[model samples]
Target: MRVINFAHGDMMVWGMYLAWLLATRLGIDPYLGFVGCAAALFVVGLVVQRGLVDRIVDAPHEMQILLMLGVALVLENGALLAFGPEPQRVRSALTLSTFWLGPLFVDVARLVTFAVAVALSLALYLFLFGTDLGRTIRAAADNAYGALVIGADVRRVYAVAFGIGAACVGAAGALVSPFLPFQPSAGLAASVTSFNIVIIGGMGSLLGAFVGGLLVSVAESLGAVFLAPSLKELVSFSLLILILLFRPAGLFGRRAG
Candidate 1:
């Protein structure tokens, strides 16, 4: 499903809102409520893929980009209307709990978030490499025509791929909701950050994306510690520029044949 989802961050914002809703209205913790968010976004992905993306699957790249941009706009505005412009943060007991490790205090919320992220990444890796559906998805991504030749339902594969991607985003939103304050306008920043991570890691490579995210996070942390906190983003952008110049294919992405 080689689709560039410009709406990814907006979808994540929706997931945050959903988790917030559950927590405030239903008393479900964001940690456990993330499952519901993921499931809901999975359906959203299916609807967007089938209703909008499928209509222009073969269109030019410009059309695809515009379509996604349009989707992003819609999601952002919808969120603003529904959630208002106030930044929201989910309150969690885990976020308040902390433990001392040596001389430093460790945040339980951050630790849990890291563990969940790693687990999800591993699960995604296993699914892609070990399951038939995952393999089919990879094949379709590599060559849609070849997949179709082998009697695969390429459209369905695309739908599932998109759904899974959205689910991942939703889960991520819920996971970070405990600490990150978010609003509709935050989606743009999140989208940019995501692009920086993907580009630094290597597009089309899950390992690259995972490593890239870690690298970016580490770099930002170092930047904030060594320089100014406000300059952290500058460091990330500088790294992105270097990667683009030296390894345009990305750290793990294959070079174009």
Candidate 2:
């Protein structure tokens, strides 16, 4: 989508906080809380889209960027007020469980997270390629005016896209919460990481994103082990710069006609 969502990272933090609350207060499993968090984030995305984004869909790009930035600020500050400044860690049964496969030991939480991520990605691909609503969304993304001319409800599709995007963040938060610590402003780093991934993989290319993330992860891991841990990000960015210099459209991005 052409939409700019600066608050996306904050939304992930919000979802993490929700899952944390459930885990700590209600003794709900983190995996189970994912369901509620995803649903809530979907509603949040729709409300933000319809209430704020829709109002400025046709506005200048600068205006849209500024608006989203403002939303990001509000969300970050609101989280600070609501959740306080403390860092939270969510512990699940899966956190420490691991299995040995030959000489390789696999973390249960990481493996399950990977499985869930793969499943979601496959489902999203199917939705985009195999369903009418998904096609409508693609149409709107490719040509909003043309989609409107074809009687496609562009705004509705946009809302759905936005909601799905938010829901993804929620799912990611739930998956990572098992091992990652959560803070009110952790979204800042997440947002940066997401931007890097999108740029490296080619914006709008699902397969590219998956591959790019793997590449980045490998680079980071190697850099951390071989070089100073603090230089991992530097290594990744250096690689990104090299890639951009050669492939300006990104590894998987095709030039739009």
Q: Which number leads on lDDT?
A: 1
Which run of 10 residues does model 2 get worst, by summed lDDT? 248-257
Which residue segments of model 2 deviate by more than 4 Å?
none
Candidate 1 per-residue lDDT, tens place, 79-150, comes to: 999989999999877979999999998999989989998999999999999999999999998889999999
Runs in model 1 lying further than 4 Å from the true structure: none
| Backbone clash count, each prediction separately | 0, 0
* Model 2 local distance difference test score: 0.86
Q: What TM-score would every model get versus the actual structure?
A: 0.98, 0.95
Each prediction's whole-model lDDT (CA): 0.91, 0.86
Who wins the TM-score comparison? 1
Which residue pairs show backbone clashes in model 2?
none
